[model samples]
Structure formats: structure tokens, C-alpha cells
Target: MSPRRIVSIYLPHFAIQRWRRRRFGPQTPSEPDPIVLAREGHHGPVIHGMNAAAVKLGIEHGARVTDMKTLVPHLQVEDAMLEADVRDLRMLSGWARRWCPWVRVDGKDGLLMDSAGADHLWGGEAAMLADIRQSFGKAGLTARAAVAPTIGAAWALARYSAEPQEICAEGEIAEALSLLPVAALRIDQDTITLLKRLGLKTIGALAAVPRASLARRFRHHLALDANPPKRLDLAMGAIPELLDAKLPDPPLRALRKLAEPIEDIDNYAQVLGVLLPDLAEQMDQRGLGARRLALTGFRVDGKTSTVEAATSTASRSTAHFAKLFESHLERLDCGFGFDAMMLEALVTEPLPQSQHSLSGKIEDGIDLPHLIDRLAARLSPEAVLRIVPQDSHIPERAERLIFAGSNTDAAWPAHTRLRPLRLLDRPEEAEVLYAVPEGPPAQMIWRRRTHRIVKSEGPERIAPEWWREKSQTRLRDYYRVEDSEGRRYWIYREGVPDDGRGGAPRWFVQGLDA
Candidate 1:
């Protein structure tokens, strides 16, 4: 049986590196100017992290911002988002799963992978480490990697080794670690200081000391890192440490390697026809359905073109999915023609099977999801929309436009009064002649036209939402009135006359009734 192997990936400057890639594009130039990340400290702002440039200038972490400003007048400072850094680190670890399945986050800025049987896939351990570093470099990250027979040894070597990519051969863990500093044991700084004071600075020197003497010195310590013997034992493989690997859900995807490169849209459609059914069969087996799907064509020149489609509801129907992609296949630029095709279900939901009608009759009503998918494919997704009622009393906030497929079943609030068929984007100011100060308008001039009120029905008063609006905000009184030509208008008064919120009440045309 082969011995267990572990790989440690250390990201020394994760925070600032991530900030630079996001602020500037991934192709950011290496400027010599120092950059530091600052966070709010109890004593005002302090340096949380720094880039390679700032490190060269001796600006260490936890330095006061005021002091650093005095030292380097041209230093660039950015607010540190530590929480976002941790999140992106987890995502980066997940992305590393392409190399090995058993991968987990080691600390705030490191990852540990059980690369026991996976190293052969990349030829050998050294080649795999090189590939890992090159991949991270391409993704705008500086990574150092090491592989050893134990997790502790790999962790120590990845961080403390002189070389960026190091591999410890089998049965050489102790010899490799003997020359490293006592800090490499992952112990506390106080223990390291004490060990150095006792003339035991190296792991080899510490190993020469009696275990009984070391235990007597650290017996009163409670923290995990305070025990150097346990850490040394773990690193030397005398004690066992298990890695808590992150296992992601299996993705629903199907791929086909083509025999020859084909650029025709019909050929692409044929490939998609086969891919969709395979995905549908996988979805059926799991009693699931896809809400979003992506079709990607890998070209001979090493580039890829992808077209995506989304449905109003979960569906596993191959015909429906194929129809959605059919119109989009023409949009793919084949370059040197596609050498492979892949179909992936990016989003899915549980969908149980339903019985079909025994009469063999066509189902009543429109297939709304299929229709929406087709329309969204033809026109842009933003071109199709559905207006859903919002939970607000303000007329303008009463309803909002969302993509057509979402919130299809949301119920509108029941109202005793009728609303207009069409509402204007914004209310237009109008001059009104009222019979009474608070009564509905008898005549009004709007949009440079006069309308004589023949019939009128409302004084529907709606108050501003106090929690969301300022206390000084005025209330509104909406009226539904019809002119002599039978054309109706929805008009509102901004405030009651002399109510003290503002000047005399102002009238405006809110919408046009059908």
C-alpha cells in the first residue's frame, strides 16, 4: 500500500493581491508604489495587510496609519475587507478541487489537499506543485506549495522553505524538517521565544531535548499551539492529523468530444440534441429539473463560446431545452470549428414526475415557461418583463417590473377602488379649479391641454410611509375623474391646504384610466 501524501498551499499576500486584481483588472501592472490595507482599530486606523511593494518599504501589519503616513507620504491605502477575503479564499480552495477531490481550507490564507493518489494525474508530485503555482499565478495570485508524507510537514515546508515549490520524499520528513526553525512546528510565539532562549532554535535541536523535560515545561499550558512536543510528533508522523475536506455537490453536466471539427449551426444543434437528452436522463434519475442551462463549444484554437438559457420553472424536457438553444447556436463563433461540446445545468430544483392525461388530448392553455424561454432567447432577457405588486402604499411604488419568469404567482393586494390601466413614469404638475378646497377638481389643464370634468369619484387619501419617509413628507389625495370626451384621469393633490407640511396643496396628473 502507498503512504498517505498531503499538499499545503500557502498564500502569503492574499488580502492585498485580491484587492489589486479587483480594483485594477487581472492584468494589473506591477507599480513600485507601496500599497497597504487599513482597518478601523481601537486607536484609529491601523495596517491590516500590505502588498509586496509595501513590505519592501518595511511597513508591517498592525502599524498605525498615522505613523505610516509620516514614513511614506505617497503610500496608497485601501480599506481592508477581511470577511470578503475569507470568502474568496474558500472559493479559491473549491476551485482547486480540479486537481484533487480531498481539499480543504488550512487557515485564513492556506489550503490543504490529500494528494495521495491524485499526483500521478499530473505526472508526479513536483510537476503537480508546479502546475498549482502556475495556475494560481495565471489567476493573479502568489502561491507557494509543498508536498510531504504528513500534513504538518507540508504545512511547515510550504510556509518556511527557501524554495516556493518543495517536495519531501517518503521517509525523509524528519531530515527535511530538522534544519527548519522551531516556529515551523506551528507553535505559539512565546514557546518559540522560550525555545530560542534555551538554545533550542531549530527543530533538530528541540528534538534532541528529552520529551519528559519538554512536557514538564509546557504542562501548565492549555492552548493547542502551546504544546511543541505534540506539534513536533504530528510533523514527524508520530501522531496522526486528519484533514476535514470540503466535498462539493456533483454538477449536472454532459460532454461530447467530437470526431472532427464542425462549424455549421445544424451540426451544433445535432450535438446539442444528444447532450440535452443525456442531461435530462441524469436529472430524471435524481428526480430533479434544471432552471438554467449553459451550452459551451470548445474550439480547436483553445477558446470557448457559450450560450445560456433559463426557464420560468424547473424542467427536464429535452425538447424544451433543445428549442431554447437552437436559436442561440448561430451566435457561437466557431473560430477553427468546435472540437468538443459541453452542456451543464447551472441551476436546478426538485421536480417530481406527474401523470399524463389518459384521453391523449392536448393540454389546455399556453405553455408559459416554454413560451417565456423562447421569447427570452429571441429578444434579450431584459426585453420581456412582468409587473408584480409591491408592498407599498405610494402609487409609484405599488408595483415593480421584474423578469417575466420570476414571481409569476405572487398575489396583488385587494383594493376596494380601481386603479388605472397605465401609470405615468412620473406625475406631471397640473393647474386645477376645484369647487371646494378639498373637493375633486372640476377642471384641470395637464400637458398643455384642458379637460372638463363630467363625472368624478374619489378622494382616496394615502399617507406617506412614516418609517421609510421623513416626518415632513406630505400626504396625497387621489381622484378618478372623467372629461366630456369620456377620457378619464387619475390625479392627486400633494398636500392639504395650510396643513403645514409645505405651501398650498399642489395638483398633478398621476395616470390615465382606461
Candidate 2:
């Protein structure tokens, strides 16, 4: 393995996954596709929406969240999740390591592997890369490769080679990379523009300039130094490739248009005639249909509104698109005028080949996901979620509400004790008129209501999860108390009784029964 030949992969715009689900849908009023902007973390980059639609209009990265909204009035921005990006990067790095032992992640989206000696193990570099590409083919991703002298030299060739989107050999590095700008070496943009103004359009052109003179004019003074013996442009092997893929476009596309822009939108019904045939043909060629459709509408002003509707059945017929978009496009405001509309089908999991037996009917039911999508289109996706518990003794941190579409791992933690459904956001305190020394409360006035405890079961003590910050720590004794009215309440008292420093014990209602 040549130690100097280093490989680096870059994922430009790596943060696009989290913002996959937008807030507004086709059933709602017309709106631009908003994105969440997340900070780069260990996982590479989290897609926090810097609305691609707004970005299409020329907003650059790191534009303040509020400023971005003002720049594009309809923009929706969110805090990028740093933690999630790190997790994703770590996973990608693990995948890269499968090809080579010395794999390291460049940034969120880039992976670098020193494939010098390892290429032979997979038959050869190009063949190895083909295998890599084939794996991504199944998973649906795109990649580019290059090879060169040093890791820096190889990186330059890989990023800017005319054949950058594919693999390059070591001997072919200099010729392939000669026409590339110095910025291809992963240098800053400002330096590249300055080099261009100085007539250094290519790496080869920049190599001929005198060191003393070049140093006086620009910061790339080191590139001109003649004393190093080795030339700055002494390129070697072709740099290996790095792959990048955005959302995979499924095989089929469906479109709908309006004859006349109408705010009432009776036109969406009338215009399904022309668009459905083209999509049906695509489904035939691809052998898939309308399991998922991303219905998009472009207004006269070039702003786009999209709604994705799905079906339980993999439908290739015109009726499916009509039924899906009927209610959805109705709410779409013509806003000046809607010029074009397109429906892109995606995530087309297999539909049944034919009717199944009666026993299959017992296992089969109407697609729950199709129903959920309908409900989400009418209501908010966040509204239709399941209660998931976290493994923490702190009442406030024990559970959280998360959107169902997020693919979040909100499983009921095996390490946690049973948590009640009615956890108070804050512990409520009350005056205890009568109580046992160590047993449950005998009589207490809570929420301004006086209650005489008939039966009490408790002493389920829970100590604070002190691994976290001291401010969040708690020591509590829980009790399930049954009062005369047949109402059972789950309550807990905080702080150990003997622990001093004037920390008074407080009582709280933790949860209620179903």
C-alpha cells in the first residue's frame, strides 16, 4: 500500500434526510417546500431544512434561519440535528470499512478509503469500484472516483477530473487533473477565483509561475516554490472515487395539469386525461405503479406545492391518481395561476400478484399505512403518533412525543420500570392533613380537593438517575392510592426524608389508569 496515496469522499449537501417530510401537503393551501437545517455532526450532515426551493433561488449555506425565511417569505427552516448526522456518518464509515480496513469518513457525506493494496483483493480497482457501485445500485446511490499522487493530489483529480464521476488510475492522474483548477485540490473558493484572475486557470498553468513572484501576488506562494525539488504539479496515480446520491427517483412519474387556473380547482378533475397515459406507460416499463405518488404543482411564479398520496394497492390505472389527488388538489390555491403539475410515484413496494386464499385474508387487511397517510393529509402527522416511553426515573424526561414518520427508535426501553400515561409536566404539591410516617398518605388535599385515602399500596421507591446533571436528579417514593370515589391516582414524593440542606419534600401525581 502506498502510504502517500490517500482517499477522501465528500458528501456535498449531506443533510437532506430529516427534512424529507414537509409540513404542508396537497390537501392544504398552496405553499413552498420547506426544509429543516441541521448542524453537521458525527453522522456527517443532518438535513435540516434550508428549503431547497429557496436554495434554488440562490440562498447559500449558513444563512441564518430567520434571515432565510425573510429572504424567501415562504421558507421553513429548522435546527439541524448534530447527533443524528454523526450516527449516519458512523454507519456509512462502517460500510466503507468493509471494502478496506483503513477507511475514514471525510465529512458527513464523504468517505475516504486507502485502497492501494486492497484493490487487488477485490480483483482490481475498477472491478472493485464496479462492485461498490453495484451494491449502491441495489440500495440506489451514485458515486464518482479518482486516483492520484498524494492524498491531496488524488483528491484534486477525483473531485475535478473530467472523468471524476468514475474511477481513475494512478498513472493517469496528472493528465486527467491537469485541466482542473487549483480549487480541485480541496482549496477554498476565494483562492480559486484569485488564481483565475491571475491567469492560472488550470493546475498546469499555475505550476509554471515563479515562486518569488507568485508569493508576492497571492497566498498560493507555496505552490510556486522551486526549492522543494518535487514540483507542485507532479501528479501520480488517479484518485479513487466517492459516491453521492440524492433521493432515488422511482421508475414511474404521474402528472396532472389544469386547463384554466381556478381557485376552486374543478380543473384538477378535468385534466387527468392527458397525464395518466404517460404515467401508465412508465409503470408498464418499470413494472410498478402508484403505491406512492409525489404530486407537485408549479404556480405561474415558479413556486411549487407538493403532496404525496399513497394507496394500499399498487395501482397503475388512471382511477388511482384521480382518487388520490381529488381531495388533495382541491385545497390548492391557484394563487396567480398554476402553470404545471406533476405526480412522481415512489417507494413502490410489491403488490399482490393475484387473489390469495381465505386464510391469507385473515392475515391481510386494508393497508394501515394508506389509512395513516389519509389521516395525516387531513390532520397533522405529528397528531397521529404512539406513546413511547424512555428509560429515565425523572418524570419530566421519562417520555416524549415524536412524529411517526420519522422512523425514530422510540421503543419502550427494557431497562425502564412501568411508566404511567398521565405524567405531569411538573410535580404538583399539596398540603397533607394526615399521613403515615413511612407508609402512603392517609389524607391529603390535592388540586384543591380533599380526599380521604381508603387503601394505599406503595413504597415503590425510585432514585434519581444521577448519571445526568445534578439538577435533574431525584429520589422519590411512589404510591398507588385508592380513594372513596373509586379513583386511583399514582403519586410520588420527591427527596429523601433525612437529606437536609432545607430541601423540602414535595408530592406529585405521576399518572392515571386507562
Candidate 3:
């Protein structure tokens, strides 16, 4: 294999430049004074980063905001926006793919590109560096680019060089870095301080000292090898890093690149019709079924639109996927026209082969799952719910509605007593007439109409458990009564007469059996 030739691009004013361009467009009048980004720091708010203008004006980074204001009164200060800077940095990385495909972000403010085989394509290393710097200048950014046989040498040279572009010859890396500061070795600040105190400030000075003497005097940890040239040789790939330039794993996906752009909904449906079967086949081969699916439309103009759907169960059926995709296809934006369509199974579950019985009806007891899946796709998953019994005695609190199929163990409890077919969520007040102190009402006035009781049964008492809650609950005596017109009503009295717990007992209509 060919030796790795890494290029490091350092953007020193990344944050400040990003903020300034956002504030003062592309054109700045004259010099536009100077600007510094200030953020909350260990010693209160301080200058975190600065632009070239600030640096030229003798303003330094990490200076306190108050002191900087005193030093340069007209200095424009803005709150630091690190997140936006990182996003722009990533975009710049994507742009750098024009030169090389293997690029990685180096620290927060710099990028490393493995330009081993790609330099010749851009007309050698010098032309590539010039192009990179010119691209940043066009984007209102200042950049320093360097190419070396080693990433460490490239990183140090890019930051420390006076010129915007630098190249270190293949075997002369040690000679090139020997005159630079001890910090070029990427050692700790404490070690650099100790080295300076010992009169060894440059890489060459440290290299001249005996290995045993250097190790014995300062036991401080450093990235030093037996000799600087030997380290350079190793870094230059005489011995390789365990794994360098590792790319992220691609997601589980399937794609269909159309011969022509598709715009109409019917055409999209036809494409999906062809793609779903292959996607299901892929899932089946992996012994997996998708629980969540995402459909993305890559437009002709380099823009993409996406829509996602989740299933009630892990499914590998093309019919199931087709139904789901059809339901949400209208929401996808077909900008220009779609050049390609991709369907990715974002979440999946292991599904083993199923055994079939030779019964007359293959799907015997529960096709309800398929029905639920259809409804959930047509509407929202949240819109379809299953009712399950909660452990409570109060009729309103006896059951709760939950997302369908979430709990496999959910079931309706068997009835201990007859409950009305229809129940008011909260009981409605009724005026009881001829209600004896301890007996059921003979008649009641509800909705401004009087109903005479023809027959009655039940004084089944239900009281609230006071330990679990602190609500205004009273003893309830429920009765199933049939009116004179033969309509059955579930009525209850809230309190006992003369029990003195609260006040006069009142009647409420809780449910209806008619």
C-alpha cells in the first residue's frame, strides 16, 4: 500500500468568523474594526476566540472581557456560538471531499484529510492547498493548510507556520520540526514548562540531550520516542496506527435509483410497489422484521425529503409496508423531482420462521392485529387505543386506555357484578322525590323530566378508599331501577341520611342500561 499523506486544515478564527459573517454579511466596510467572542469561562466571562482583526490589534484570546474593553474600547463583543461553528466546520469537511474522500474532524477547530492518493487529482499538493485556502477565502473564512508525511507534523506545521501553505518532504520531517517549539510534539503544557526551564525549548534541543539523562531528570510523561527522527519515522508509517481513517458504519438500508425523475403520486406509488417486495425479502433473509421504517426522497437538486412510520408489530409483509407508505406519501415534498428513493428499516426485531397449520382458515382467531395495523397507518398510531382494566374499584377508574398492542398481557377483567352498558364519565345530578331516610327513591327528576319508579333492586354500597387519595368522596349506595316507561337507570345516593358525615343526601344518574 502507498504511504499515507495527511493534510491538516486549521481554522483558527472559526467561531469569530462564523459569528461576524452572520452579523455583517459578506462585505465589511474598510477593516470593520475588530471582534472577539466571549463566553462564560473559569474566571468569569472571557474572550474564548478572536478574529484576524482582533489579533492584528494586539488583543489576545482568553483575556477578560472587562480588561479587553479597557484595552480596545471599540472592540465588538458577541456571545460565543460553538454549536453553529461545529456545524459550519462539518459543512466545510463535506466541501473538502472535493479534494479527498477520507476526511476527519481534527479537534473542534481543525480538519484532517487523508490526501495520500488524491493530491495528484488536484494537480499536486501545492495546487490542492491553494484551492482549499481560496475556497475558504470565498466563504469569508481564513484557513491554513499543510501537507506532510505524518498527521502530527501536518497538524503542528499548519498551526505554527508563518505562511498559509507548507509542505514537508517525505524523509526530512525530523529536520523540518527540529526548530519548532517543544509544544509541536503535542506534549502537555507542564512538560513544555519544565523543558524550557531546563534550557531545552526546541525539538532539536530535546533531541540533543542523552535519552537516559532526559528520562532520569524529568520523569514527566511525553510523546517522546528513543529519538525524534525514529518517532517521525514511525508516525510517517514505518509502523502504522492500529486503525487510521475509520469511517462510520452505514445504516441498514435499501435504495432504488430511478432511470428518470418521478414527480406524480401515482408514479411514486408504482416505485414503492416495486421496492417493498425487495425490502421485505431483504428483511426475511436477515431473520429480522422491521418495526420502524423511514422513506426518503432524494430530489434532483441535492435536497432530500423524508417520512417515517412505526408498526404495531415487527412485520416483513410487503402489503403491510405498501399500506403504510401510501398513507403518509402525501406529506412528502417532491421538490423539483425525485432522482432516487430509499427505504431504511431504522428499528428491527428478530423474527423466526413461523409454523403453519392446515386449518381451513389460516388466520383463525385474530386478524385483529392486521386490522389495528391498517387503522394505525391510515390514521396515527396514537389515535388507535386499547382499553384495559386497571386495578381500581370505582367504575370510572376501573379501566384505562393505552396505545394498542403495547402491553401483550392487557385484558378486560371479568365482571363481578352487572355494569351498565353506557356510563357517564362523571355522575350527573338528579333530584330524588319521595326518597325515604334509608330506602331507594320512588321517583327522580332528571333533565327536567320526572320518571316514576316501577321496580328497583340493589343498594350495593361502594365507598372510596381514603388511604390512597384525599378527594371529596362520600359513601355511595347504588341502585338499578326501572322507570314507569320501562327504561333502566343506574342511580346512586351520595350520602346516608342523618349519618352527619356531610349534608343531605343527593342522587346522581351514573349509567344507563337502556
Tell me, by TM-score, which candidate is best. Answer: 1
TM-score of each candidate structure, all chains considered together: 0.60, 0.48, 0.54
Residue 6 in model 2: lDDT: 50
Clashes of 2: 36
lDDT of 1 at 412: 88
Model 3, residue 359: what's the lDDT?
Answer: 65
Alpha carbon lDDT at 262, candidate 2: 42
- Best lDDT goes to which candidate? 1
Cα lDDT, model 1, residue 379: 91
lDDT of 2 by residue, 22-115 (tens): 3332233323575557455454443344544656776666545555566668655566656776777767777776677766666555666766
Models, CA RMSD each: 7.8, 16.9, 12.4
Query: Whole-model Cα lDDT per candidate?
Result: 0.90, 0.60, 0.80
User: Comparing 1 and 2 by lDDT, which wins?
Assistant: 1
Kindly indicate the candidate among 1 and 3 with the higher lDDT.
1
lDDT of 1 by residue, 146-248 (tens): 9998999999999999999899988998899999999999998888998899999999999889999988888888676988988889999999998889598
> Which regions of candidate 2 are displaced past 4 Å?
1-252, 255-266, 270-293, 296-324, 333-340, 345-366, 405-410, 413-421, 433-436
| Deviation of model 2 at 176, angstroms | 13
Sort by lDDT, top down from the best: 1, 3, 2
